[model samples]
Target: MTESTAPETGTPSGATGNRKPTPNGTTPEPVDTSATETSAAEPTAAATTADGASVETGEAGTAAATTPPRKRAARSPRTTTSRARSTANPSNETPAPDAAGEPSASAEQPGSVSIPQARHAAPDEVDSAAPADVEDAPGDTVDGDEVGSAATPVQGGGGVVDDGAERPVVLRLTDVVKTFPGVRALDGVQLEVRAGEVHCLLGQNGAGKSTLIKVLSGAHQPDSGVVEWLGEQVRFANPQAANKAGIATIYQELDLVDDLSIGENAFLGHEPKVAGFVKRGTINRRTREILTRLGHGEIAPNRMVRTLPAAGKQVVSMARALSHEARLIIMDEPSAVLAHDEVENLFRIIRELTAQGIAVIYISHRLEEIREIGDRVTVLKDGRTTAASLPARTTPTRDLVSRMTGRSIEYVFPTRVNAPTEPEELLRVEGLGRAGEFDDISLTVGKGEIVGIAGLVGSGRSELLETIFGARQPEQGRIYVKGKALRPGAVGAAVRAGLGMAPEERKAQALLLGEPIYRNMTLSTFSKIAKFGFTDTGKEREEAMKVADQLELRPRDVRRPVRTLSGGNQQKVVVGRWLLGDTDLLLLDEPTRGVDVGARAELYQVIHALAAQGVGVLLVSSEVPEVLGLSDRVLVMREGRMVRHARAEELDEETVLDLVMAGSLMEGAPA
Candidate 1:
């Protein structure tokens, strides 16, 4: 509840009105006039309007005014510079509302959020005043109120939460524009990243996020705009130049050499040298130190990069960035490949990095992650920043979604359909066992039922799915479809028995990336579309077009290469392939692995629709919540064994995680 003041005589000092003389007859302080500070420590206070309104910020940074003589300066501009910069420029990123509740032209800047300026005060800044001196430290208190600094929990790990507004901007982009042959990939993009803060970049695929990152990483140059590092404007000629200037980009597809050792990968291009000789010992020692700092000391520097898991590879990437002494590390979907516990560990590393005054540009499609680890957010849509520097935790999900997709969306799973009382079993695995991969797994998926498998990365989830699909020969198992046994090691036999699988690695296993979408979608039924042993392109495209419309494939073009589509669309094509065949049981491994929220919702609806049509669905997912929400029944896998099986309604995310993480020891507890 906000504390509001009743109306009083004379202009209220801090009530969105012109300031009147203090009750004690002291004049209001004069506004400072100076340039913005890039590295100076500024005071922390609750954000207020220039005319002294108590802007109470809430979800999505929506602001409401309150009556008060002194308003907290929440989201205030960098404390390193006083209110001087805003006064001198009058367009310092924060939008002010007019009588009509629209942003006044004088207060609005490019990429500025149109919402009223209701900046939320950090916990320590609730009762604080602006720093009285520019030279004061960030932790300095003012008028008995702790300001600009707070420590909070991130994904169950505690870390200092620095007030980003109080920190000096280390990287700034002004009206950055870039264009491809026929596309404007970035248009007048503006971003300001402060030191010691996680500035999250939010956008849907094709929203210019990739282009923006490319521009920042020196892979592409902006046709027009300013790129300022620290304080000086500089244009990098290539990725190496950017790295040399303390900027590192860790892309979703890590660029480490597989054959190289961890230490060698960490310092690939610029290995430590002494008198014109590469210092292998020095490189190993420093790599070990970096790994230790990242909380992964168990990984030996001499270990081959190819031997590391996805999470371990990510740690090596970070180590490589640190090896270059990067001040700002750009992470693109760093958590996409990580499991639950691995995601927590990643957040811990990010917090530690921020505490050391290193800035981070985090790009991800997961909104919950933005709330957990982000300090501020800049949203992009259609090659432009829709909103810049909004409070990450306070911003409503609807607001962010609207900015990214140009419309509000409720991210919800489809309504569950009740399974028939006497539904026929569509698929059954009796005593399924794959030596070293899985053991003694028995489960049944009834027609119109969705059965989900939940497990860790190495808990044999993917391997089990593949084995059931006949991609791998099981050491011992009886797989049946609609009561008929399937050949042990024949994918063709599995398909003939009405089984279709969308593998986890879609590009590598499911779809031919270089092939057109229609061709890829009709791969399973090409024989039906052939005439005299020749492929019928027209028939294949017509069949694919029907599925495309059902799936709502973007651009509605079937001739484009499968690789050109987004992650979600690629998965759709893979699933659509099964729709062409007489597939009664569908197997999905990480179906929504890299899909955005909007696409994920659509896919959920598709799955539900398939189940409603009496097609059995079986899937494996790293996200426990997804499994619980989408599945009718859940199976927990751990250490190559089936540990628990229950209806989805009888399980929750935490319970599932507990079983997956500690099920081996809890095997004796209960199913």
Candidate 2:
């Protein structure tokens, strides 16, 4: 299921769903035009019948209406009545009479309506938006000259745009400003999205991308500046209002109801009804249709959402958006939870959505994805627009990195120090096996040496780390610290052996959110500070303050609750706990998972300093770059097996991805 590596024109050919590639390497041509083929068929516009009831066609508007007219149905609460008519079918011809000399049922009742596919316009005819003399809003000013001045919209890839016409602008923000009590989350942010295009939003974790998305999704109101949707200024009062206004957002942490069925979750807020009673048959049928278009027809509508896999959950989220007839969907870290092959499927679905004239604002940290699926780019830094509407494909990596970090450093790893000729083996694992999780895991970490593991979420990366730390019992094999065997399933034994672990879910697994940072830092070594059955708070704070200074934790306040600290500082406290314990070996799982770019650099130095002091480090991270850049040796895992082992300098990102996704490629294709 890997995308073609061969070059093609327009957007990447791998992004073109339901299209057949010609052998000559020319632009691919659409081969399937059936209604079920979402990328190839045009979305049908709803027509008002004589009785004033609206009717929508099945896929591509090919189905003949069969349902008879009943009582007038109440409008769906989640959808607005006023819609901008699609230019795709400007002239709606009346249905012809049947053999009985009467008009078809479609002439009497209309079905559900979807936002029409956008019509592409010539570049010269496109409006660049606002005159240069327009004054900026207060607090900050968006550089008007950079707005759409450098962007030449990529063409001939997203559905109807293959003819070289540029899609119309659907969402625009100019000098948008949003502020919290103590932080300015958004300052003079500028962004523009066009119908039938994927606009990528790039930034570091704390760079205000989340706040901007909340503003666009109507979860928060902008303090100043303007937001225009479909050529008119609008401020959505709440999330529901934005949903009704053809906007939807899918966050990284999914909002799906676990107990509900697939069909129920898809239509939870706005169920089709008559006489105040929901139509269960209608909900099931409509949901099935949407799933089929997404290339997952085998998924039963009655299946419980909790039973589905991560990729399945993502598809259901997209189905929910289409159910709302959303014209613009904001996806925050959509691919973060997906496996390699599943990501290809997601790109395919996105191609179909853009083909149907839906605008998408995709937010992700992976820079490689921007080149694969994005048409235009907008970079945000420090709550302000650093650059707006740049070409996603041709922009240099150095330029994008400099924009997001305000510096030239990328991957930001501290220089690796060479080990002694005969390194001291600090820890070792001998064929450790955990049934149903991981098997035959064998590795070693030497004094002052760093080893890294690269894998997907379910590839047993976290499980292996936890098992080594004695948090889980292994069914077979053995673990050793300094050539001594460790007792299986014993946390106390592992700790006494000088093994320290910083888990992946630090908030849920590592930190005591309600307690003071000093208390948490002293958790592993409280016995040393306690005298005569009474704890010494003064000594505890003194010990915590020393590590805080070394790690350069923000505010350096040991007495403040850990929850009050930012994500980066909270992680520092977890690492600091081990430091106070005088641990010889450290195991880190996703150490930089939520830390921002600036704080990440600081944490890297802390880790390097620890290794320089003769501590052995073994780390696991989903990001291949992090694994390779920060370690001397790398191991690739897939489906509970160690597939490849090599030095960090011998492996690249693509090679590691291939090793992790080997078995996934042979899985059955969607539908």
Candidate 3:
């Protein structure tokens, strides 16, 4: 598990002697203006004074510090001099300044002030204050002019203050502007990151976080703006160029070769070579080392990446970054596929990287993670920097959320008004078991009901859905559709029995990536598309047009390739295909996995409309809130057994978490 320290609240001891007397007769010597100026200039110095060990900058700036050259860890702290250098040189590769501005003799004593050790705790257990401190440390020593005059104290907590000593700026963006066909994705945006800091970019799906990263990583070139590296201005022509320049990016859907071994995937296209042949032994050794740094030392490098758990695959992605000697890492929604424990592991790796003078840029939708891991924050609204930089310590999660959604977010999951009706059981399974996957899974879906199945990754949620869909036949179960027995392992039989499934993997198993929208939409309902044994292309287009209009597919182009559409729109196409089949029972696994928030809201509406139409919907999702919010009833599963079934209204996140942690919900089963 990743360990994080708490945010310090007491006034810094270094500023004690610098305080002056107030007009009200109170002595206030703790506000040292001279020290701030001196410290601000020496951004890369590691100064340990009689008062405390004060590293001036955050992680982004720490790259300039004179640390031993070694593999980087995510959460390492920075020194005072490092912070000063970062502020001075906002570019990508600017080097550290000379020793003249380094730590003074008086501040180098070990017995002067004792520095606090960072606490090791789980991501959830780490106090919110820790993340806040990380965010505040960066701009604490900036000139008064740079500090926004209209700053307000964040509510629900005491304000966070920088100690003005030990913080690093891990990443900095200046006047970054990017333009799309008809929209400016990013406009003169400036962002800064500190080492050992989790800096969050808060914005709605299209608020330009992805665009900004794309520009930084060289996937998209900005129309205007200079990207600075370390302390020097630099531009990348492509992702490979940025990667070679020491920037590694992990996207929402990982870019890993599933067919390759973990070691091969970790070193894809850059495998170690001795002479003319690929050096498998060298690659495996390096892979093991990188995985060890990520705190997963036990996973064999020779194992196929596809066979690993989803969270494990994510770790492998990180390992790939480490293999490239990445100094600046950008992670987009890394937690989307991770469980509670895996997230903790990711945090640990972040801390370790920072310790080694590496910087990280983390983008995620989980506001709680922002509050837990973020050191600083940048809020983007409509492609503009609404909030240039906010100290994570002092910023409220609600305010950050407001900036992202353009409105106050009281709850993530909107409450559902209706309950499941007991009209009749639409589908039933008894002792459903798949060898080496899950066993003894039995559940029922009622007519017009939304039943949610919840479990951790590798706990058989997707497998169970597959079994019912006939993609994978259960070895020892009886499936009854409307009280009629059905043969196993026959997808045609299941489809004929009024059952339809949207598989977990939408890109590979669900949609025909190369096919046009109209054809892909009609592919599932070929029977309906035929007239007198001849396929009716005209009728198919009509049907496709109707569903496309209903789902708000962009451009209204039925002939466009499914791959050409955005993730959300493509998902709509997939779902529309199953819906067009007129199947009575719908099994959806991770229906909205890759779709953005706006599209997710649209999907919710569709789901409600489906339930209103009396189609039994079995919704399976890894995101707990999605499962809870959309379902009429939720069935908790663990180790392949049905643990508990509860009405959605009677359950909350905490209760669901408890059931997940307990591994079985049989004790809390609804009476």
Candidate 4:
């Protein structure tokens, strides 16, 4: 049978540093193609896929003589028509047979049509969209110089690209410009994400990466430029429309409801229903399958989201995306909350997804992670794209860093120092026990000593930290600050006893997010800032500004609300609040959880400076390198047990992993 004629889109160009800028409302000239390339003006009444499967558009054509079109079934008002993409190359894989309960055409028929996977009832009907057809619309242009160092990342070449032929670009945004009252959030940004690639988005906190994803996710409509999705011109009305279009976005802050069960959250707006009633069993069963496929079968579908840990919650978020059958999933900082083992699991899942030909947009600040998982890289600075679609593994760290920060970052971690051997003991836990969380967790932090806890996601590191801070009462144990006993289950008591804690969940557990930065910072020493029983706003701001200055917090304005700050700056606010106090012992839980590499170095320096000032620091971090580099001592925990205690300099990453996984103390190590 002869192939049907259809629109053929031009090749999407990448942003380079030395290329001349493209004019507004226009795109660069189409890429040069061979004479054999199909022309864009060809017309047809059927959809031809990269896999060679054909979709009969609801139109009459030459084949209409013997091949009658399938009956158009009644669709719900909310139902959207499934979109068809242009073909990359003819696939031998059969397009799924006509779906059940809709329409059917026998295999012997001449014009059998394949239904779009999303619109079909059968789960197997979907294939990662045939290379989406491209649409040429006027858009932004960037300096078009090719990069030489894109292949250097140690962790992130997403998958094997077609060495024979590169995968077709599935999504492209040309000259996309979005603006607000005083800010142009996306200034002529250009991006191209190829099918089956882990395209990473990198930038400093204020960079337009978030805005760009929001545009792609349909949360924000671009004020200018063309957004070609799956190779078609589309303006998503909202996030729902984007999801319907096979573009799923997993935000850094998950959008799942805590009150909902795992399955309910997974299929929130699109629940399986029978006669308008939700089929709870069906949704749960399907969710279970998806979770299992992602290598997390232990997460029960009936479990409430509020009860899950950070990593578990992340998995639930991913499960939701898979449930949507997303073809191109945008993951924003997906590994920020994951432990080492959990990250490995995430990479494994990503690998599995890509092997099935599903593309992923992975965002992370960890350079090593980008090396391991990303196939290509796009760096955003301010509101524009600086470097676009560079090979992920081959890109050197210096180039990536220079692009993100607009300056070269010489170091990712601060200089390490050994604590004085004769330092005073500032904090001690005596048989601290939290039932079902952590047991007999006893540790001590000497003044000027940084004690780090290394553990997997469910290893009770956070719970123990909260317990020591008096946020949770231990079933059997006591907490002491400089040998002074703290009242059980009392945060105020802990604060009064000279113990301050920067919790793991910065947005929820710490900080008055909605309050002004100065107000939040002054919370720790409100009484000290009071003038003879009368609160003084001026005095409060003055003291808060002093600490904020020392932290070098950006914007340098304490009047702005804490919620307006970036993740790194937000963490600084938490630590800065403690900095305004007379703290003897500080407990930091995942201090650099969502911070970028540049900010992580700054935060490490702050912690060290504090410890050097005779303040004891007890910190928990999932990154073994971070724990080892910043700590004077290391405590390894696994499944609620403090299994090993060793000097930081004495234990390497491998040994720490061994102790954590085996849940046993090393030979000749402190019990």
For candidate 2, the per-residue lDDT at 429 reads 87
Taking the tens digit of each residue's C-alpha lDDT, what string does model 1 give over 11-108? Answer: 11222232223323332331111222222122233344432222222231222122211211222211110000000000001111111111123353
1-671: candidate 3 lDDT, tens digit per residue = 11101110112212235222332334321111221111123344344333221223433233355432322223322211100000000011111111111111234232121111221211221112111112333232122222332243221111122222233343456556776555666766667654445567665555577668767776667777545455334556666666655678877667777899999887786665657688898789878887777778899999998898878888887787777667678887777667667777677667666555556787765555665566666776556664644655455554454444433333323455555567478898888899878877777887888999877767788988888888887889788999999888888999889888887667788787677889889887978788988988888889999999988875478887776565567778887887788688999988776554444656777777777788889988766777777898888877666677888778776677666666444742421
The C-alpha stretches of model 1 lying farther than 4 A from their native spots are 1-165, 296-300, 406-412, 418-421, 663-671
Cα error, candidate 1, residue 612 (Å): 2.1
Candidates in order, TM-scores: namely 0.74, 0.75, 0.70, 0.72
Off by over 4 Å in 3: 1-162, 166-170, 180-183, 202-207, 252-293, 296-320, 379-402, 405-412, 531-538, 663-671
Runs in model 2 deviating more than 4 A are: 1-160, 530-542, 555-561, 564-567, 594-596, 663-671
Give per-residue CA lDDT, model 4, range 1-671, as digits (tens): 01111111111233234222222222222121111111112224545443222333331112122222122211111211111010001101111111112111235222111222211112221111100111211111122322223232212354553322335555666667787665666777767776666888877666677667767876667887766555444566566666755678776567678998999888887776778788999888878888877778788899999999777888887787776667788887777656566667778778766655567898777777776777777776666666666656555566566556543344455566667776887887878887789887788889898999988878889998888888888899877777888898999999988899999878787877678889889888888888898889888889888988899887688988777777788889999998888888889998887776556767888998998899889999877778888888898998888778888879887787777765465332332
Taking all chains together, the TM-score of candidate 3 against the true structure is 0.70
Computed on alpha carbons, the lDDT of every model, listed in order, comes to 0.67, 0.66, 0.61, 0.65
Better of 2 and 3 by lDDT: 2
lDDT of 2: 0.66
Stretches > 4 Å off in candidate 4: 1-157, 257-325, 339-342, 406-409, 417-419, 439-442, 474-480, 483-490, 666-671
Model 1 residue 152 distance off true place after TM-score fit, in angstroms: 13
